[model samples]
Target chain A: MQLFRGLSGFSLTPTDAEGRVQADLLGRLLQRIQAAGVDSLGLLGSTGGYAYLALAERQRAVRAAVEAVGGQMPIIVGVGALRTDEALALARDARKAGADGLLLAPVSYTPLTQEEAFQHIAAVAEAGELPLCIYNNPGTTKFIFGEDLIARLALVPNIAAIKMPLPADGDFAGELARLRARTPDGFAIGYSGDWGAAEALLAGGDAWYSVVAGLLPVPALKLLRAAQAGDAAEVRRLDAAFQPLWHLFREFGSFRVMYVIAELLGLCQLEPPRPILPLAGEVRPRVEAALQGL
Target chain B: MQLFRGLSGFSLTPTDAEGRVQADLLGRLLQRIQAAGVDSLGLLGSTGGYAYLALAERQRAVRAAVEAVGGQMPIIVGVGALRTDEALALARDARKAGADGLLLAPVSYTPLTQEEAFQHIAAVAEAGELPLCIYNNPGTTKFIFGEDLIARLALVPNIAAIKMPLPADGDFAGELARLRARTPDGFAIGYSGDWGAAEALLAGGDAWYSVVAGLLPVPALKLLRAAQAGDAAEVRRLDAAFQPLWHLFREFGSFRVMYVIAELLGLCQLEPPRPILPLAGEVRPRVEAALQGL
Candidate 1:
């Protein structure tokens, strides 16, 4: 099994006035992710694209991402729901959409035991027959995947990798070490941290998913390339260059802010669907300034 | 407009084998809600039986609750979604199901701004044409309904109540007081705290919603009625009586434990839907013992 490497992040579609899929903007986002030289295309994950899209909309997103990459890069699509049946349905949709693999995150409505987590993954594996990356973002899921759970999941078939975003703060180093130790040889482990991308990469992460890569691909890809080459000096240089946009996103929220900055940079233009409080009057300008600085 | 008083908890449907809606159990649940003398019934909200059910199952849950109540008690249903259109559709469904009111909680898939929150409530209010309680459970919604946001929502048509849950273990006493102060004369505020219910009731909550109430209505109602009457001594007595059950729920997890305890008591003999891990083996017996104590 090959480990997923380099930068990978999802860009979401903005809904239209009629509440239908904004297909064109989504296609543009796929182009942007490709231009960023992303090693893999992550579709339908929470960074923007997948959190609230309907089944059909999600399918459209997956297809758009794949089509934009023109089969050059693999697309990892997110499939999650409170009910396992619904999640199974999503897995079916992901497969039908021609996704290369699946990214599964347990829904937060119900907590899962470590054993159940293993079972949940196994069932999805059986249903979809697709390679999987267990997405472990505890803040969103509210259930942390402990070492025992990772060890159990490692033994499950068709689990290609793990996309882990440790909370920026906390004593997560121990958990990180445990994860690294427990991850099976065939399964790759990737990191997702707005600020800690470089550090995680330095600390043995195989890849870092980048939001900046959605809008500014070359610089992000350059950073990933440098990090993979074990050039700490060049990695820092690229990290410094991307720091302005990073600081802007951190100033706002992680998921929504990235959407706002993407819109500001002309990567794609559309409003986030309702419920994400929009960036205030001065904030968009601030994002623009940050984008310019970057 | 009138303040929502009495029990504002969900009137859940009992499901049968194959995960289908058990109309008989649903009817029985509604009858029990009425027998318990709860002032209001919330059907098809997250807890009221639709969380695991299919769209048709959810509609049946609403219809069953409405018919069982037979216009004897007010019914407020939760209509939330990751999509605005879906939430609007649910609101309209609530109206057709003969709901007395609607409970609107913004879904995170479409994260709402304060203004969008107003728009969402306004759309639902116009569609349902019923009294509404803004269910502010930040734990589920991922959006905190602050006093200012609540103040803005207070202007929405037919918004009759605010079901605000205390956030985290933070110092919300001052914020609660502010929320109450900002409420217009016709609006009421209720509480939902599995372990903190007694204390939350004492802290100016006009009424409270309880999962425990579904199984043990007599005791749950008695506790709340005592708390409402400002008889601290009676409140203590009833709370002590129910304390073991409450403690078990808190010590274990929410909802799943509630469902298991219901099954143990023969109130609702259904296992929790998948993705919600059941109680640990040792924890199950403790819950059983606590129910026996009750």
Candidate 2:
């Protein structure tokens, strides 16, 4: 069965005070997310701080999520790295750890050509044996997969989906339509920018690879359900309610803000890894207010 | 002694047909550039394909250059990586391999905050006793060190210079003046973007970290020497002569064009690492014509 559809909650990698992954905490968080009716779990996604953790810690997190879910929900692991060999190694590790699919982003210090990107995903797909979802978040990765490239990569047998960031101009409907026209049949297209998930899903995007869903799955699911049922009014209400949190995300990146939200909600007690500082100062009251509203 | 002044040639990592680093070829290339009167040798700079090579291979290349140069010219090694710990490791290895200085770029797959960038460089500076030159090529690194961040990083004890990309608008004089006013004295400001090297050097930049210099060192140094001697007429004349090559660099990236030039000159026989296709097809005759003119 395919691993991605509807809401795939991107789980946070909980860590102890010394910044080591706390597998038990991760397991518990996944359990809570599953209980809230989220469709799938995506471990080590950007919101999960996958880029910041070591290989062993990432492997531990993936293993913990798979154990916690116990096949009740599909587990997709983010397996992205700067080097193709490293990404291949991580893909293999994720598959061995029982992940249902791989979320691959073209990570680079030097810019990669479309040919390089295609070959990278093709290699990982050949190596991992699991379905792959190309994660295109150029805001962070600096590698944009244009429609032509996505169409080309879709020819690979194992590349089942793409999780894309919403265009900066907020043209969700137009962008979704363009992608649908370009991509082949059975190739699922999902939206990742949490703020745009409801509109994108309502406008016929296949899934929402969501950050908010990981921490507040019940509400996130409710919003997704509203979109699925074509209740545009309800979707609008939920999107409005989420505006405060979205504001925080727009100001200081979703990764850092998500850590603050998880800690604020008492879902996890881990600081974001070093180099990523915690949310502080004037933004704290606003975040607290948003959490209270939620 | 300072490893950078005038033209610091960004040497290519000569590789065999199988894509393995040919250390002997790399050594000979460095020697030829030294003979051309390049002020210093910058091995493993982006032009060297440092990002593409494995750690041991990078180490071997650095050691080979050090041995070949044999105190004939100072050697600066590029020690940049995705992770902070990995970068620190590479910096230490470069120092151990007898590199005279380190060229550090803030490499990231996930975008880094200014705080993270500063900390990464600070940690490397603490670990690697060799003098460090910050390499600010935002086009590739996806991490820009603004004037404020550059000022703060300059305060780090061992950061001696910066290799800055020429501004996109080609306002070399204006950018150089701005940097000179902000950074402290004794901080050598070098310019990359081979197209702008003559103007950058003439506008008070202390060095030119040049890709063209690595392959066509004789002519590159003549341009630099003219700029250094304040011969504006000669500088303009040389830059005019180099216009055709600059046009190719503008179309494709410097890394790819430089590979074509090096191969055309009979200095090396290596393709630009895979994913970076060699210059061919419609660009071939144009490149051939340019080489002939040079």
The lowest-lDDT stretch of 10 consecutive residues in candidate 2 chain A is A268-277
lDDT tens per residue, model 2, A3-96: 6788999888887644478988889989988898788888899988787677778888888888899588888999987666678789999989
- Write candidate 2's Cα lDDT for B1-294 as tens digits: 447678898888987544578988888999999898788998988898888787788888988998899588889989887666678889999888888899998877557889888988888888899889999989888888888998898889999889998887878778777877877888888999888887788888889999988888988988988988899999999898899989988788788888777767777667776655676667767777887766
lDDT of 1 by residue, B208-271 (tens): 7667776667777887788778888887777887777778766655676767766776777666
Q: Each candidate's iRMS in angstroms?
A: 3.3, 3.1
Model 2 ranges with Cα > 4 A deviation = A14-25, A53-61, A281-285, B14-22, B281-285
Q: What is candidate 1's TM-score for chain A?
A: 0.91
Clashing pairs in 1: A12-A49, A36-A217, A274-B110, A274-B111, A275-B111, A275-B112, A276-B111, A276-B112
How well does candidate 1 score on lDDT at residue B25? Answer: 83
**Which candidate achieves the best lDDT against the true structure?**
2
Cα-based TM-score, every candidate: 0.89, 0.91
